[model samples]
Target chain A: MFNPTWAMTIEMVIAGVSVIGLFAALGLVLVLMERRVAAWMQIRLGPNRVGPKGMLQSLADTVKLLVKEGMTPDGSDKFLFNLAPYIAMMVAMLLMAPIAFAKDFRLWDMNIGVLYITAISSIMVISILMAGWASNNKYSLMGAMRSGAQIVSYELSAGLSILTIVVLTGSLNITDIINAQADGWWIFKGHIPVLISFVIFIIAVTAETNRAPFDLAEAESELTAGFHTEYSGMKFALFFLAEYINVFIVCAIGATLFLGGWMPFHIGNWEAFNHVMDYIPSSIWFFGKTFFLIFVIMWFRWTFPRLRIDQLLNLEWKYLLPISMFNLLLVTAIAILKWHF
Target chain B: MSGSTIIFYLLAAITLVSAVLAVTTRMIFRAAIYLLFSLIGIAGIYFWLNYEFIAAVQIVVYVGGIVVLIIFSIFLTQQAGEQLPKQKMGRQLFSALAAFCGLALVMLQLAQHEFTGTGNKAVEPTVANIGYQMLGVDDNGYALPFEVVSILLLAALIGCIVIALKSKPEKA
Candidate 1:
């Protein structure tokens, strides 16, 4: 029999390698999905020349980026400039640990899973700040500053919205949260409050990840690629990859929290319907829910105009923050009263 | 040594080295970054002890909130690329003396104290236990101190708003 320590070490190695592979695959697929969605919205064919239906377009881009020289500016802080992208990539990858792709399949099922995610994700802003500051460029500094403020502000609402679900479930463990949805998803069962927090959560996370409408940090016309103005080649690609991965992570968390995670849709006393839903694999359910949310986020990107810096702050502090705070209270009262199904 | 013992030593080394670097680094921005690593190392130590809740809180409050704020202030107030001005000889000597004294005091205290490990009987540092302890009305509960801390935070928030609020410009 294999020693427990050796078995654990092997398991960890496998998990680490698979996560890196998943990052690569996710980066490719998400980039393709974003391009296609954008193209469809914009009345154009996107990257059709790369491969069949342009499925390998991101792969081509990756290859191109890999070969391109990663130039560090003469005046830039060489040490930190190189370190910044890796930090961004590390934060993105570390977020994968607590997420459950399927029932009985996860990395580290620590007790404080949700809290762990929020804590680690808060570190994302530091990477941006480092990149901006290290680049020694005016635009980069401005972009980094804007991102720092934006992320710090939006984090409040995002956290409060997440706490709404945590309040309902009375647990922080991802598995426990999922298992609590066995009867029905919180969005349906918890009713108005859950729906409100879900909306707020989506908006908050969109801003948190520095996505469209809140993509002021990298506003192409305004800041010339923002904090990453100095980065090139694979270094630049790492940031791009990190962005996509962050989007996926946040969407997965959203799916797990607001949607039923891997749980299938079922109504009380609908045994046949429930069994049919159960026949669908849990991983498929998780991915479907996550992708649907991702599509919605991408849709938001295509539809809405980017908010100005002040307007973005206003939307968070004056609107989302207050509303989410109130919603948290409502959810708490509901949870206390056992009003949720 | 066991794997956990090796891990503990590694974390301690990281924490101590990064903390020293944070203070000694001439570049203000590098100091902040080093401080961040030191805080993260401390969080890792907490995780190593299986106090995951405390570790998360450490990362969230220190690395995320405080370090970011420090970096922000540095960005605003200082040229990050510029080296910080060197301290005067007297000031440097005094600071070193102070730090040495503090370290010696701590070491002396550690040598004087007799510590008994709780071993396997120690309470699990789970979130639920932390929550209960924070709010519980029992003798060991921290409900009073928790409320006091919240009140203190509220006071600080109000004070900040008060200080930052702009006065109306007088018409010339």
Candidate 2:
């Protein structure tokens, strides 16, 4: 039959289907949620006609995308133009493997799960570059270059912030990181330094994901649609999906690292509080923490103005990186001294 | 072929083909993409060998960091869309012959050695283990190498800052 490990193979197939379903559902709900949030911010009613409270708006959008013609710009590199969207989609899917949704539930709980995530997410930058370069347009190329510079700078602070949490937990395994916070989440447990790291992590990951005010890669006002200016229909949809999935991944990891991923709020030796928190399913708590973080990100998008390219780099290189590096040391001290409360 | 052997060969095929494509491609952009493929294929082999940490680092540093940097530079230089000039036929033939000789020599060297599988005792190296080794709390620790790398990185960063901040003189 030319097969190897039929049982594991079958399990992977099942997990693949579930992952696809989760990705689609999350995309639909987040898009709908973003619209409502945007409307609330702008004092307008958003997409309430299609379904109850515009729940089916994303579905309608999906159908429209499906029906639209997929096109390539006339002077574009045809092969890479076609390939760029898949590159983005595949990177997102690859990143999905390391996330742990519930107790003993994950695609691949590798020993270096967190590092794998940091590594795989970097591919998203390449996909953007490919799309921009292949579009054969000046604005697209400019957008892509801005993104390449932005992501490279921001990743240092992001990685350092994550390593801060890793120092506190003594492991890069996501589950191990989570379980270490059973007494209390890092934000609540590791005193002031962890709090600082958490803040830096949030800001760095916000920039890393290219959401506004850092969303200059596709900055609509200046570079109309940016790297994705030339992409239309399904290819654009893939890029959109990848972006949302990336948000979910980074937030989920943040929750896992700092918010006691799938961990309910438990105070030290507070028996009743611990019991109440434990009653909720781990998956629910997981998603709850993740969504709360996502909401925070969306709130950031609506509240802040887009940063200038220089301001963004200056924020990272000067402010975030130094602060994160200092926070890492403070955390390492807290970790060594056993000073965490 | 057995399953593991088949996988090994498949990964080898991907790595070799992509490396060749990376070298031979006319378009610089496609060459970079092919180099990405080759790096990822080698990472796949590391994953196959169960060196998960090394595999992750390989992807993070090479495919993700260096290749992206290369592509970014190409974009900056406005050379992403251009085709590289072809080498003369005589030079191409000479390089091809040299490449074959090198490959055959490496193959001969490899064939002289014996490789044993330790599948039954496969080591699942953890991040914690790496951390301990990096900190050098135990025997066979890498603390010196780690500190050296840190110093090297520090020196590089300082060099970068100095170079970037240096101003050019105005032409008279």
Predicted chain A of candidate 1: TM-score? 0.98
Any runs in candidate 1 off by more than 4 Å, and if so which?
A1-5, B118-120, B169-172
Task: Give model 2 RMSD, 1 decimal.
Answer: 2.4
Once fitted onto the true fold, the runs of candidate 2 whose alpha carbons sit more than 4 angstroms away are A1-4, B1-7, B116-124, B134-139, B143-151, B168-172
TM-score, chain B, model 2, is: 0.80
lDDT of 1 by residue, B1-172 (tens): 5567777899999999989998898988889999999999999999988889999999999989999999999999988578878999999999999999999999999999999786577776777888889998899799999999999999999999999999889999
What is candidate 1's CAPRI-style docking category based on DockQ?
medium
| Second chain TM-score, each model | 0.93, 0.80
iRMS, all models: 1.5, 2.0
Position B36, candidate 1: lDDT: 94
